[model samples]
Target: MEERLIMDLVPGLEGIPAAESAISYIDGDEGILEYRGIPIETLAVKSNFIEVAYLLIFGELPDRDEYERFKSDVTYHTRLKLKILRMMEWLPENGHPMHYLQAVTSAMGMYYPARDTLDEEVRYWSAVRLIAKLPTIVAASHRLKHGDEPIKPRNDLSFAANFYYMLFEREPLPLVERILDTMLTLHADHTMNASTFSSRVVGSTLADPYTIVSSAIGTLSGPLHGGANEEVVRMLAEIGTKENVRPYIEARLERKEKIMGIGHRVYKTRDPRGEVLKGFIEELIAHKDIDSGVFELSKEVELVVAERLTGKNLHPNVDFYSGIVFNGMGIPTDLFTPIFAMGRVAGWLAHWMEQLKTNRIYRPTQKYIGKRKEPYIPMEERKRATAR
Candidate 1:
């Protein structure tokens, strides 16, 4: 006789492979990640933001013609629709940037209603529009938070440079622009992260790209995901100085409180993204000269934590130095995670496109843990049934 198979249910799908994807790879034990088989560091040093984005969404490097077309398409669509602008203005000035991003992006599906998610032309244009407008929306949200007027997107500038322009209505230094570009590349994609999975799940239902992206942004707003960077910055401020690092870390460790930014759920060793950002932070500190104190404090804290966390496989994840790098670039901590969403929009859309190819609505099984069915009771016996 043939035997039936029994499957074990994993909560949160921990260690379960959800879907097959070729877009990105991660070896958490080895502390390695790659996009389309290209090392992130290689792209970080050599490629610009748009090129890396093209590579991620399309599955390979773009040639000159394709690259130019892709860049032009993104540049042309970079401006927010007047309706989107009005919506931004409608939001409370004090509301969270991520929340505005989520609401506006979801509403885009209503604005530009999609007739099809599986159409190549529709998919391509939707991806381009989301990637192009994300930075603009995020920058506008930041400006609104400060009661400042929104700056229009610039066609002449690169993606990162244009974001900075929209952010401050001023030109970024060449070095800063390049570093910010590199940061965008570093964040462009990761293998099945929270937001990526969220996007894929929504896309599986044949939802339009805008709704899929909005769903991903909502996932990103979670404290355990994208918000960790903002927490890192706040934690550093709470520590205040290098002198306070030791005691603060000791107390946290003794209390078993998490040392935010110091460890990761996936990586067993140091996160390569963290290492890359650390190098950028060091380079930025050298350039700033006068205000390297925060950099020093971060390093001091790392050293103290390193000694205590020796065998815990703990090391600085991407959040550790990314906050510092953004701070060095004159960006506030609150906007850090939203900026992350801007970068990650590429990855989310890529996964969305990929999911449509062999679409299957995500319907995972659950282990039921409720009382077995009881016999139906008459109305007269219902009160006595509850006492059981």
Candidate 2:
């Protein structure tokens, strides 16, 4: 063994980059976003969610025949397995749906036990099942908890349309569907964030994609991670009305508290997704007659907070505007994270497939800080140390 310096990266610690994908790209500093090399604003106005997903997975926009086939295949697989339905029924109504989703996805791996003949075809089908059933599972969990009837998936509608239908048991208005589709595309992927990193870590073990995605979902459930959207909604609700915005933000700044949705790990300037979502909120407010004062309040909060903390280099992220948009769409506050999972599932599956193409077990070493060769003493023999 080489006995490297503490906290140093050993050989092969930094893995090779995967194949070039035409998925979403993040330029954190410039606050620019692109999907398939086209700017996000262009896609938001022209492309739909399904088209974006196909592009991410298959490397380009599908032709008419290919798009139709892809839509049919996904729609056919949208219905949950009977056993999975029963499993959802068994979950407590008060339980968080993300927890239920993580459990169900892990259980799915056991139900469809892995085989020695796991080939590309197997992986492809596994991806299909995961992508198809995720929305159904999330929608069912939402309805079950709220004591509402679960709506069956309609094969004729687009992915975003069907998801809205299942959630509300009615077809969504065209503008609503368009906004949601764009939102999905915007969130489909980014360069290796926390949840994507978690999926890749699990996948590096040559584990099944289902297990990898399940682990990713668990990582995303943390408040500091995927739950930021929920916190944003909560923050807005507490702020109450337009009149309270300034004072509320000023008070928060004085306490030196970090506002949810106001900062990012990768983006030092502004988040491009935040810009896109803000536009969506503006459209929804104007055309849909939705109250978007909360969005204005959030913007004011961003400005005041940034000015006060100058050197902190804070900026509002995607989650900042997403909360207002979802709230305006009449989505319940509790379902925010589950909706985020809906968007992120596509990215997770894509990353998992990419990892399998170059499978390597992830095993990082940690610094050893504990005493070396310490004797194991009986419980009574040890003396308690005084607090410093």
Q: Which structure among the candidates has the greatest TM-score?
A: 1
lDDT of 2 by residue, 1-388 (tens): 9885557645433333434444567776777777667777777778877677777766678999988877777779999878888888889999998998888888888766543214777776776777788888888889988898678899888788898899999888887787777778778888666788888788777788789889999988888677788888888889887778778888887798768788887678878777778777667757745666666776667677777768977877888878778877887877777778777888887777766666666665676668888899899987879855
- Local distance difference test values of all predictions, in order: 0.87, 0.77
TM-score of each: 0.93, 0.88
Distance from true position, residue 28, model 2, in Å? 1.8
> Which residue pairs show collisions in model 2?
none
lDDT of each residue in 99-179, candidate 1, tens digit only: 999998888888778759878899899889888998999998888878888899999998889999999888898878988
Query: Candidate 1 — which residues are off by over 4 angstroms?
Result: 1-6, 375-388
Considering summed lDDT, which 10 consecutive residues are worst modelled in model 1?
A: 281-290
RMSD of 1: 2.6
